[model samples]
Target: MLPTFAADDYIELAADLPATLQAAIERDLGIDPAQYLANAEAARAASDVATALRAQGVDILGTSIDGQDVTYNVADEADAALAEAAGAEVTVGPIELLDSGREVQPAQDHKGGYGYAYQVAEADETGSFPLSRCSVGFSGFDADGNDRYLTAGHCGVDEETGEQFTYPVHHIELSEPIWATEDWANEFPGPELGEFVPGSMHFGEQHDGGLVDITNPDWTGVPQVAGWAGGSGAPDENSVTIRGPIDAVTGAQACKSGATSGWTCGEILVPAQSTPVGAQDVTGFIFNACLLGGDSGGSVVVGNYALGVNSGSTHDGRTECDSWVPATGPDDTTGDFSIGYSLSTGEYNALTLLGSEWELSVAINTPQVTSPEDGGQTGPTPTFTGTVEAARSTHRVEVTVDGEQSYEGTIADDGTFSVAATEALAPGEHTYEVVATYGNHSRSEVASGTFTSTEVQAEALTVESPTNGQTTDNPRPSFTGTGQPGATVTLAVGDEVLGEATVAEDGTWTIAPSADLPVGERFDATVTQAFEGDSQVVTVSDLGITAAPVTITAPEDGSTVAGDVVFSGTAFAGATIGLAIEGVVTESSERVQTAADEWEGELVVGEDGSWTFTPAEELRDGEYTLTATATLDGGDPELTSSEASVSFTVGAEGDDDGGELPDTGSSNVWMIVVGVGLLVAGGVAIAIRARRGGSTA
Candidate 1:
């Protein structure tokens, strides 16, 4: 009989947990301790009901607990009502079980070890090539205590030979050769393996596993699993450590680390399921978590316990239902359902292969730091916190700071511990290392990090006006901010100096640019404050200075014109010239034209940022407007430019002068000559009249 934990025990445990763990349990998992205990009890009751229904010959698919609700999947609606009456939520769906097949070939190349994915390639006598990619299941020892790696059995078998064979297993990182030794296959039975299976399909009878020799000195063997909390494909300093294997349970949240997909999690739908693939029947755990082609043989885990190895995934025709689909496969596929063989079954198979005397286990599960991250900077005094997985074994965790200052603590019931530096040290670079010593005096690998400490007093600095990401047309914008009193504030864009200011007694400072900023330019206003001997810099990025819109004020709208048509507009400094036709084309005979008349012209903006459009020829009798569009190149799209227009009408042919008037449109000189001729004639007529009047007197 197993020991039972009461509700009060859970509440006490929750209350005694560290602040970090409590926050994680509540924020990430969304469940408190009392609620968790109640849900567990409800799940147990639902399981008992399921067992009783099975005894009564009820046709049931499966049962699992989702949150506080105990859910039962059934093939018939009548069975759902029966389950609901028995205090279980019911869902109707097909039993659609699936099995493991050979992993698919890789599409791209990558390199990693342990929980990382790898490719295995082999060529036959006909020069035909067969390739498959799979992840390393776990690192362990065979019955003879020989160091080895485990993976899916189908990864090492050849279809041509229909049997297991030795082949070179390539690691993504190392150039050295790693070989997979054909130790065992689940469906294929060796002469010695028959005794362990006998007639039982639930045990080693349908196991799918293989082993790789890892006695090479170049390879490092650590009891860590990659892709914890959706990590990258490459295993780095943040990989999770495996505590040990645990029994698979339905409705339990499970996650797997694969080479292609990194880490993914879902609930276990069926703990023990017999599924059929192409021509083989595989018995394993079924889950809804995403699995892809290159994810085969990855580790499946629940919390800190290593549970199983990924085999394959199901391909149902409903691709829209799941969050992910295989990178390379058919479309409209709904089934991301995956299957994994339990680690216990793989361990038993290994024992059967090498003899029952050997034991398979993980080595040196170390502690990890959760606060004050590696290569980070902190103040003079710092508190350190981390977690360690020592199972039920007694162990002492020691944290060493700067190789001199040391603090020791014991692992908690939930595998968490914290320690604080006893004294504040002088400002400098500091290092920390955490080590765990077991009851037998065996020490784990050290987890170490380095950080910098400074003694400068902290001060607040903020930009109070024309905030970050603001757009304006003021070229010499004023920047105001608050900083430490008596501090010098220097503002710059990249390496070019904008201006500087000194903080007043009230801790307020302002800076105005010495010269106008370029129109439509975006830049970061890097503000640096220096006080005493310490200085800090803050950057306000994406500040924009927009260009003023072009405005045509020279040619008034709806005015009449006869000749020398001129269009003028004002725009921001350095803006480019742009023109557009704003009206329909009118014949010379037309008396009036609206703004819809066609108008066309182009001109360069003056150095003063003003533009004037002057037609080289005389204007015809018509109405038109020239629309001017000015654009500045440096600002965002929204502040680029604005359109401006002026409309006027060309007077009739004889409205200003007689139809016989000389063509003065050719040149200004011709118009000047015609005006001089009229003046001389008038003067001659006036002289003659005065002479005649003198004769009459």
Candidate 2:
């Protein structure tokens, strides 16, 4: 078992703790103390090397450590050898490092407006009617202590002129009437209305960000970012604070606060990525968090550290917003991906674009949990312990079991606290939450863990092979589990008996169903153990049986043909046929109704399980891969029979005689015309002779 800590706590403790203290902390937390210390040291050493390389102008993406080995995530694989020679292990990342050009679009309608995080502003074109809504990135001051704020460069640019500056920005915070038009010259100093000016914009080939000058004295900027209190909880007073920028690594949890989605947390998919958006290229990190239109310029943070700025989502294909849409049914498959520009790059660009006069920084760091690990499993009476960085402050830690407060406690002087559940937990998996609050109601992000409570006196039953929720192509799955020694075990599906086995001397049992289970049916596998007059039952839910395999026969692979081509295949009877010709799916006819069970359309499958397909139109002269897929009715649509594909080529066109047609031109036409003329002259003479003879008679 490994000790668990909050992500931020792990990073801090790993980098700053003494070796002896690290070991003692790990041991107390039920983790490998020695290995943890070694890994920490190695990680710190690797970070130093990375920092040096970065200072020397190397484009290192990020770095992570596992045990005593460090893996450097770099864009270029050629740098692997050089990084390894620098005294630590290294690996190349799959991300490409490219620049993203200017991003622009028309403004959108919003429900309401606010000052802090979700404040909305519009950028209007100089002589046109185009405008766009954008959010404020963060607040910072120039070297001269002048107030300024940051936003996306695309937000300030005029789409028609392709220019950044000269565009008028309008906001309601300091402006009177809040919804005034962009007639800046006449609207200036008019009562309660005011217009903000654009100072500088950078649509660098590598980044799409900019800084806007907030000249109004009535408007103020805060050092804190907008987010949920704990990374995953609801928005509150103790949401998040801005610390300095921190290097982002893969597998770390990151959150995004935007005007659209508010705050959502997801793991960092790629620490460094360079991808193309339309004509422009963007270089940054890819996260699994959801982003939407008008979310640009939002902050991407990890705990107290500002990591990146929201750029755009990959789901947007330039036509419409492709934000995450939840799956509607069991077969509905949809996904959305988001991208952000690293704060490290953003900071550099900020200084270069706005001149080295501006200084950027964040507010205070929220308290963090450092023990009992999130999402860990333990006994029913598991001990809950954690620590906060705030010293000499009264800390109250609330422990909630399945969303209800069960226990509360106070922290000790050493920044540590523990609590034991007073009530007994039932035999099953239960979720527990630990929320630590310190100093004037300031609360740390909530920490959560899950634990399963098993009765000591009851026989421990655990499903071993063909684990719970396992999907298999084989209808008859092998089931194995451990139970009380000499106990009789019977496995069943609903009311149907599968098989039975007796626990051996070692307390293990195995069984297999005598008959194949129906495909696509979700059923629970109940394991019953009877001892004396008592019985125990454990179930594995959602075991899936997949479709059978299939094969294509005629129009053999690697053969050339033309005209009407025939495609045949063999599949199980009553199975649905999916045919694709040159990557385009063809409509399928109903299941064969005849005794032989033959199905027909562009493709035909016989009841004997043999199938054939003939294209309705003449086959084009080109190489193609004809694919046939079989699907069973009750199973998942994604889980179907093995696809059968045949590659064949269509040759040149043919004639009526099955060969090239003979050429006939002007000569044949002239001969037919002359023969008709001669026949007509002879027929006229014969008619004249016959008329004369009849007059003489």
Candidate 3:
């Protein structure tokens, strides 16, 4: 979702958050920070339209926010047209003040949008102290360089006992093993991370916050925040670097990671000074996200900057964050909002409350170039890759080639970036430099490198695989060799084109002939790989392929015939033919049937490459299968074909014409037998006709 062209949130969002943080934002919220803000803006505009129409007494059914489209559902198309004309897409929806939003009816779980909400708060501040817990927000340095963390001030106060209650801040390595389960805060008491500052807390009508003085030696002065997305894996929850306070913007996305609810993100419905029912006239802003009872004191952030501390939520009855869901947008009037105490301008600004001399941490490191060595040769459009400070949010990278053409890309969460030139650089010695911009608009030192561009100067093609004189059994053999990537490689035999392949990214090429080459025949082929035009060709000579598989060519498989039962096929000259028979049976009597036992033998192939063989005995009038396998006289395993088989029946499908009859020489015998059978059939027919009193015409 894109914000309105006039909205400043988009520009502010792009500038406020670093690329790594932006990536994390999208990962946790399931909404681009810009889109989340845009949705809010769009929803706000739509709400105004709805209110105006309602004032005119227009009946609005409901409202929805999808991307930048804010719709108002009307009872009829007449209202739709009117709403559309008023600048909001017609379906219907709203915002305003709250009377104890925390005590309002539970928020509708099935709200509009699919944005993710992190349920990361730990103990419910509403829960009785000693048994309840609150979440830590951000870390900072005190006037004496002492490490300090901040949370909601009301979280440390025990309203029940009113003794200024302080609870142990258990320290656990933020990971799935220790922090994934909801009850792990109580189950795994790793260690004491820090201590709540004595008398350094406040919960007034204008502000609410507290500071936790860091006692752990290793964690002092660290500028990191706990980032979780309500999952069983991924320490993504431990990410997010807080670079001090930044004023919050209405309609922008805000997130908080807590032990009670992992990580929930939503849009700010109001920037500040909103009246709500709970804690009458509480000093806070309203944001639409899933904040449970224990979320109080959890850090609320907009981009990479610290915004506020979670105070409480309207949906305090919810137990768990079911999944990442979208915000209801800023127009939501249904008391489904959470409160956060301002850290930038409120009376409880962390800086003033902690120590006037306290300063937030900011880190920036120079990026390192790891590709296109100091003075190496590379293709014109070489890809540049490098690394930046791993934990830093290096968002943008720029690479200039020869101080001319430049390429840019977003840095990844892992603090690495890659940019490939869109066009070829001028051929010759060129100096390239890379620069990265990360957190708090910190720029990395220009990482420079020197390289010579080959332009289109491709290396001559080489046919190394054939190796001058090579032979194989592959009828269509493939050729392999190295060449410059991005070049087209061609394989040809004389003027006849075989096939072509492009040189792969690994500087290699492979091609094979489209059709099988003649067996036992040797020839030379030319291969050329180049850009723009053909380059010098490398010839692969004395390359040959082996013979074709033996093929059966007699009696056409599946044909029925009564004859001498001969099998014929073609094979390599001087090869031996191993013949095997199956499914053949002969019946000596009608009462008994006998199955033919294994019938197999070997035959010598003739010099002409064609062979014919006849079984020593006649086959019965039944189906049979004959298999002929050819074995090379002394050929290599890579130079021979597989066996061939055919099936035929010794009956009506064929006669002596296709196969010779065992003892009979001509068709005269068959004619005589037919003439005798016909005479006997006529006499029997006349006798039957006389008995039935019918004519025998």
Candidate 4:
């Protein structure tokens, strides 16, 4: 009966391995023991990733685990986009089979050989003995520290019936070894080492295993797998170590070394199915490897971890096991059909079938980072969290966001951990990495992800007054707006800051320009609100805020009048209203106008911004144009209105205007003489009118 273990045991597997096993681990996997263990934990974590991908509708062909990476194989190249989005490398096609780089396996002879019967002699070179050709899988140790052997159950039991049979284990010492650290193998099997344990042999649809009590300690430790040389009968090459549980996922490679077909390799196939084995029909996973008789019960491994035992292959044991016929479908069982049984499914575990005490050693598993999932979004102050197995309290965490160290500390051993960011993170996509560096009873582990950092937003900023396309005469106009409290708003003319203010507690802001805004023409005003290192800006253009529009607004524009002509119109209440009669009618008209443009007296604009002028003198019959304009009182005289004209004619072209002009066809010299004659009189009349002037408001 295969037993069960806690969830923790399924993730990380750690051990203080024998020095020989350590050496073998580095020799084959080319990595230290700690990394190998951490990688196993990382590989286990990928099951959840596959689940996530499936949830996204991506059909995974297979999966291969190596070191810290898990490569997924998919049929369609388009699936790559979906796989990578979930943070997994994708291979578009079947598994890639790597050459074993070993020697041709030993010759196979069918002995009705459900297994082989190798020759053996005494340890002192005495006599001959009996040995099964069925291959040995992984070695292990019982809780009592006693060495044990693991192999296919069918090797020591009846596949059709359930009856068990005892098989003697053999061993020998080599005088001249071939590429080996220690010189001992079952080549020319020596003496009997041990027999298969009673009740340990069992074969069914789900499980197949038999345990052996290896009394002789000559073999590699429980953490190591045996190796074989090219065309050699003795099992000499012993450098491959058992790191952790094999990745049972498809697209992973299965390698083994057995009594016959010594060292053969194959890659996992897609869509696992069951095949008939004697009376029961149960298979683990499928692969495209070539296997023959005497190879059954051999070790099935992926990477450096122990998987299970070789169950069956389509190639009969009678012929040379050289040709490989890749299976086209699950029903295509004629050739290249091979199968393996996994040690543990979610419900079944054959590794501990013998007893809970008997076990294989493995490396430590890595902790998984669960925070900031790839392509996720979070606030500036994001917290880091993750799931871990074993030694929770001793695991120290160090975190970095976008290459900047964001956190570093220890976590509780509650199978999970959480670390808050010490400082605010910047905006945008930030790649974060988490390292479980210093942990008691555990090796270092690395986890990483990316998330978009977004800032907390306040209300939108707005300007209430000085809106787009507004016209005003007030130079230092008070600007107002509604925005986030404490935000600063500044109005600028070109590059010059006109006014600035901070929004009050009521979310309202007002600004009085430090200097008057430009006048007399349309320009643009930029209003910006800045808060928390970010700013929002808006521009208001074509603001009609210039010199006051002081246009002549009377005399019935284009009207005709006779001698007693009075030119009057609106202007700045405090400014002067002056009329200039020019053109052909100038010489015959009287000077009934204010000398404000000439700066004779200040014409202060009234509070109502309006003023009118009443002339005193009458005009001679002639064609004349009247233009009235206003000038600022206490400012630059050039700041006068460039306003439109209010034109009128005295004895000018009109509908029977004022009878006929006195000088309608007169010579210019005579008209000038007449105007000069009236100049002194007009001056005297203006002086009298100024003295008698009334309020122009």
Candidate 2 structure quality by residue, lDDT tens digits, 62-101: 7653333456666675676566565445667643232333
Question: 241-318, model 1: which lDDT tens digit per residue?
Answer: 555555454666566666555566555666667655333445667776666555666777665556677776753322
Task: Please give the distance, in angstroms, between residue 513's alpha carbon in candidate 1 and its true position after superposition.
Answer: 94
Worst 10 residues of 2 by lDDT: 684-693
Model 2 residue 295 lDDT score: 60
RMSD of each: 25.5, 29.4, 22.9, 21.5
Give the distance in Å from residue 136's predicted Cα in candidate 4 to where it truly belongs: 1.3
Off by over 4 Å in 3: 1-129, 166-168, 172-182, 185-189, 229-238, 274-281, 323-335, 346-348, 355-358, 365-697
lDDT of each: 0.54, 0.51, 0.56, 0.54
TM-score of 1: 0.36
lDDT at 669 for candidate 2?
A: 14
lDDT of candidate 4 at residue 173, scale 0 to 100 = 40
Q: Which candidate is the best by lDDT?
A: 3
TM-score for model 4?
0.38
Error of 1 at 304 (Å): 1.1
